[model samples]
Target: MRLNNKVIIVTGSCTGIGKAIALRCVAEGASVVVHGLEQDLGEAVINEIEKDKGVLQIEEITNEGAPERLVELAVKTFGKLDAVVNNAAMILSSNMETTDLAFLRKVLDVNTVAPFALIKAAFPYLAKEGGCVLNIGSVNAWSGEPNLFAYSVSKGALMTMTRNLGDTLFRESGVRVNQINPGWVLTETEIQRKRSQGLKDDWYKDISSVYAPAGRILWPSEIAAAAIYWLANESGPISGQVVDLEQYPLIGRNPPKN
Candidate 1:
């Protein structure tokens, strides 16, 4: 019960990594507020939680007042807030030729602005409770593949936001901010996207070593484990760290042999 009696908010918890983190937090004894755009998927996640341990709220992160309402809901339901995992994001594959400026702004709004808004809205409660803000970033924030133009840019801003706030907040209000940069996770959306790109049904089974050094890509649960450690108070007095979760160092790596 590492997080016993804690109250946590996990956005985009309807599926994939966000769902895993919410489930993990619940298992560790936290009462959770699960937010997502999909009603049925959100309910599906809720069904797995222990009785009275989780509440589901359907929300679009980019909507007006959504962040404030989310924070208010968590505080209202749980009586207070202890942590927030800003895990909701929009990912699209488009190169410069295909990506328009408007779409790029839309990506930034969802990926970066939304997280920042949530952070601000939750700050008062977090400060009172000495809480944690954990952001789910991507290794692509380092410089994604050319096709992920807008996505990469958005995540890069998120990285900077994490560091800037982490350094300031923990020192000022005892609220810790941190981020995780994950690589090649095998989530439902990713599988579907890969399939749409013409990959075979068992594509994961044949993943190349360059992408998945352990013979497979990362699992959402694996990322959740690290997230829990950082969010838990036992880690103590640490903040502003961006962990690169990958098979190889992100920079200066040799090109994969195709």
Candidate 2:
């Protein structure tokens, strides 16, 4: 009941964290625009939610006019837009030597530029309702792993944009902007991602304690629970904030040797 009668757009929500957030929003009495690259997955997500509580859109976030279409879906189906969860992103690995101009631009297009476009499109509706924007960022925004050069840079830019818009937009339009930097979430995509890296199927079952101090990575539902706070009116007048949801210290921590 926290988000009663609200309408939200959740990008890349066919699976993983975005999917979890979309479902949770519906459970809290909000209608959602479920979007992703996969049509089948998007339809499945819409089917799982209440019949009147969800709609589906299948498209690449970086496609021309895609952001406008997503905003239109929310307004047309649910009557208005109250929030946007910018969850779509391309997670690619690359080192300095391997990263090229095209590779970095592609990453930025999805992770950084696309999210900003969506926010711009949703701005008018959000301002009308005093709505919010919750950007799903990563702990990697701050000095990421060596292999995640392009990805880290993209997230870093997103974090900065969140802060800047959080301040200006809140002041100018009454639309709050905030970010959550999740660490090591055990999402469906992550499971497949690790497996593709040549790790065993059950690699997550035995993570190093240094990485997962709680003995397991965070779950999508956990992240969704936190997201509700920002999307709901309970987070009044609090903008320009970046929260890190991780098991261990993201900074200044010296892990014990294995």
Candidate 3:
């Protein structure tokens, strides 16, 4: 119970990595506020949390000032906030040549701006509790891919925000901020979508072998484990770091397996 009695707000918890992180937090004894745009999936996540006897709240965070509302709800319902996970993100594939300005704005709004606003809104509460912020960045932030221009740019900004916030909080507020970059996580929906695209079992096998470099694709829960470690109070000194949970060598050189 590393997070015993803590209150954590996870954005985009209706599905994918966010949902997994919310579930893990509740399992670790934290009261979780699940925020998403989808009411049905959001309520489903909250129900699952409640079934485990964990305190859970749900909020829709698509509107302007929604992040502030989410932080307020966490405090009013749980009495305090210990951690915030900026896990909500939207992925769009369009090269610079074909990308529209409106689509870029939408991507940036949801992926970058929303997280920035959430951090600002959650900062006061987290600072009061000496809590942590975990921003869900992407591996593309470091390496660029052609079609994922906007997503890559948004994640790049997110990483910068993590560093700036960490420094600011350290000097002024005592709150820790870090980032987690997940790679090729195969959630249920993603798997199903791949199947619908006529991808066979062998296609997935080839994908795991050729693309992920770990000989397998990651599960959402695996990424959640990294977040859990960062959010737990024991990791107080490990701030301002961008942790890559992609199982790839940081220096681009694969190390010998022990």
Question: How are the candidates ranked when ordered by lDDT, highest leading?
Answer: 2, 1, 3
TM-score of each model, paired residue for residue: 0.98, 0.99, 0.89
Q: State which candidate has the highest TM-score.
A: 2
Name the best candidate (by lDDT): 2
Put down candidate 1 lDDT per residue, 129-222, tens digits, no spaces. Answer: 9999999999999999898999999999999999999999988999999999999999999999899989998899997788778999999999
Record all residue pairs in model 3 with backbone atoms less than 3 Å apart, i.e. clashing.
none
| Candidate 1, number of clashes | 0
lDDT of 2: 0.94
Residue 61, candidate 3: how far off, in angstroms? 3.5
Q: In what order do the candidates fall by TM-score, top score first?
A: 2, 1, 3
For each candidate, the alpha-carbon lDDT, in order, equals 0.93, 0.94, 0.82
Model 3: lDDT equals: 0.82
Residue pairs with backbone overlap in model 1: none
Residue 81 Cα positional deviation in candidate 1, in Å, after optimal superposition: 0.3
Kindly list the per-residue Cα lDDT of model 2 for residues 1-258, writing each as its tens digit. 999999999999999999999999999999999999999888999889998899999999998999999999889988899999999999878999999999999999999999999999999999999899999999999989899999999999999999999999999989999999999999888899889999999999999888998899999999999999999988889999999999888899988976
Error of 2 at 116 (Å): 0.6
